[model samples]
Target: MRTYFLLCLSIVLAANALSDNLVQAADPAFTHGVASGDPDRESVLLWTRLVSPDSPELELTWELAKDPTMQTILKTGTATARQEHDYCVKVIAADLEPGTTYYYRFRQGNIVSPTGRTRTLPRTAEHIRIGVANCAKYTGGYYHAYDALADTDDLDVIIHLGDYIYENGATRPGDSYYPSFLATGRQHNPPHTCVTLQDYRTRYAQYHQDPELLKLHARYPMIAIWDDHEIAKIPMQKSPSGEPIYDAAWQQRFNDSLQAWHEWIPCRAKQGEVIYRDFQLGSLVNLLMVDTRVCCKSKVDKTEASLKDPNRHIVGDEQLAWLKNSMLTHQATWNIMGNQLLFASKGSDWSRWPGFPTDRNQVIDFLTEHPRINFLITTGNAHNPHHYVVREKESSNILLHEVLPGSISSGNNTEKSRSNPAKLKKLIRAQESNPDLLWYNNDAHGFIVLDLTTQRALVEWYFVTDIRQKQYQVYRAHKLVIDVR
Candidate 1:
């Protein structure tokens, strides 16, 4: 017993020593960068990860200002970074004016983080601009999409649909990878495969260090949701053991990953809970970010009977209930769903709403019933750009307009650059012919910008020529407007 106790003591001491070393280690600059999310009327959530070797969680302070120079201080507070939180800090600055712009920064013992700018929602929004993006595989290419977003001024908020990070372990070949993908650049990285807290935190650190991502985080207030990649690929609640399907270890890893995610990102998850929450951007829009990967069924086979399963669900019963209640109560001009995966699939190999027809019907029914509601869906998975119109069958009017922003770096519309373009074109055509499906781009590297007013909502798609090249070019643009009755 004494021998066992001695071994345990040794392990504890070694851990403490390692932590102390980490705290004392040279701090990584705001590499992956700064970000803001979950904005309320008077406050917004600010995030930053410190790369110090000796201490992961360092005590830090933050300040909010009314202008770019930060000449006038509005709010200031202190926070700490530790191993539990992957050395990240999230601060909520309150008591500010509604629908106003603010600048913020983090300070740790004179090491000042990059200055970030954010805006709070107004009581009534006359004009608002939103940037939407998803599925950025750092290993695939550069983060020029984010850089372009930073350069394009006048954004009210940035919303990420999902797949903020990839879990594919390594970047596949035939891609010009970015510096952020290199092993050395991964300041905090998952070991072997990320099935643990440390793995998730490390993955976040790796992604956050990319300068382009940091710039966007510094430039705008973001509202984000997590897709399958945040935990594992296409995870469903079907297994009591969960997606990866192993008891003790995988469950612990999932819990740890979630805990670390809450620690690193500007999100509010009360331990073991899912990342399903809602945010209001003044009176202009209601953003409901939902997690469909958890407690849900994976994609079913292509059999007609399976595809028509009445029991399968994507958002599950509880979330669907919450969504119904929320949609009924929403008074905004535009009801935006920050969805993670494509609600309408274009025959991709992945699992999406098509695999769960019953729930899809219910959701469509709800949208149809709420005829007065103008809805927009933003999503990340599919790694391709898609615009679909969910129509109210009886009225023949558009009910929901979905914008699937292509990944900053992920899959493309092309099938290995070898498949018949005509077939893909046919699929695209079918989707567009639907009254609800307006425009879709499966091949591109970019984000979406939405400009909304009380009367109408205008959406613009921004495409980058190539993310593999350090220098990117803009290739395409599309705009759509929805008028609210």
Candidate 2:
């Protein structure tokens, strides 16, 4: 017995010595921290970024648990964060239980991270609540919207409708807030404007480093889509086309940026594309995430004549067809369209379904043809919250409902021209008065929370107090409900 005890003591001492050595060598990176997304009934995508003094390869271990405290382990795995991939780690874990909450964490050499809890989609329509949002610019201010949404109780999913990051050039010197944010206490990493694969990857790394973003991502499963900002501003067809447009180089950059996005985000890629895909939350609802960016004929310049170019395409032909068929064939009680851009005010430079008239009309026609379809559209790109009614050409009858969840951090850019404070105030008042143009919250920065059942779908909009400050305050600003027929 004495010999055995000594042996055990020696082993424990060796282990302690090793742990101490690792702690001494630990790097104070992980600025981007950890996140989880693309949750399913039984699985989820786990993410983390390890920022070295200079990009360097690192190894990490991750684990999932049944308890928020992570006392009970369900499964665990190992992964590498190589410089070849920007040191961002994404692991898809399977075999989890439905409607269950799981806790996850990552471990570097010697330090363990704070735990994050994520819940799987419920198997049945006992009822599910979800939140939707998009367009968060770290420079804007604090993530009041994220703070508010984080405090929100009973959320099953958080749907982000795009503009996840900005890829603009240096915001002209003295642009102050435009270039680097005052609150984030610094500018974006790769500090210069992004146009290449490295630029895009570093930009995502920078944004994901926000504490508010990390908190929001750690909590709920996110259903996401990409608008122009995810790549470059308004990269419609060929407009502002990146260098070597037709050359394989541009395609390679586009694909590289997309692959990096896929590696960093929780969403899946089908056939090497992030375009259109569907998700079912028990029997209560189905969310169709579509790509409104690729495969379209380039936009005619915003010239007067071009505005009427009945040929401009936003949803593209293939995607539009798929969207219609998906809506028509949905088996769930509620059909939700996770579109990136605005649909109500088409024919505008905004480039939503409106930019593509033929496609927009077809969508309108499909809604009319399928009167039984209880449809709801959740979108981002406006950077502010908006609610509108989708109508058929000849009828005032509301054919569909759209909830434009605003940005978590990003604010309105063209507030002076197209969307000013006066028009915004009017729309806010119109919430109760106008049936067609229900509501709008242009000044605030925040996100939307959604609850769905067989009989109705309800959305609650949360507002962020200020993105320019270190402290973020969130408020529940608005709510809307659509009763299914």
Clashes of each: 20, 7
Best by TM-score: 1
TM-score of each: 0.83, 0.83
Across residues 354-389, which tens digit of lDDT does each residue of candidate 2 receive?
656667787887878878888788887877778888
Q: Model 1 compared with the native: what TM-score?
A: 0.83
Those runs of model 1 whose alpha carbons end farther than 4 Å from true positions after fitting are: 1-32, 172-192, 239-246, 295-311, 345-350, 394-397, 415-437
Cα lDDT of candidate 1 equals 0.69
Q: Over the stretch 1-485, how does candidate 1's per-residue lDDT look in tens digits? A: 11211111122122222332333346643334567888888778888766656665567788888666667877899987665656676777888888777778777776766677777877777777788878777665788898788666677788887778766575333433323345223322453557766677778777765767766776778777777777777464553222434477767766776676677667656566767877777678887888777656544555776666655567777788887777677688888888876786455523677567677778888877777877788777767777776656576666677887777876575622324678777766776666555666766788888888899998888899866567777644788888886
Which candidate leads the pack in lDDT? 1
Ten contiguous residues with the weakest lDDT in model 1: 1-10
Model 2 ranges off by over 4 Å:
1-31, 50-59, 169-186, 238-253, 295-298, 301-312, 346-350, 413-435
Root-mean-square deviation (CA) per prediction: 10.3, 8.2
Query: Model 2 reaches what TM-score against the true structure?
Result: 0.83
Clashing pairs in 2: 130-450, 137-410, 141-467, 141-468, 142-467, 346-354, 347-354
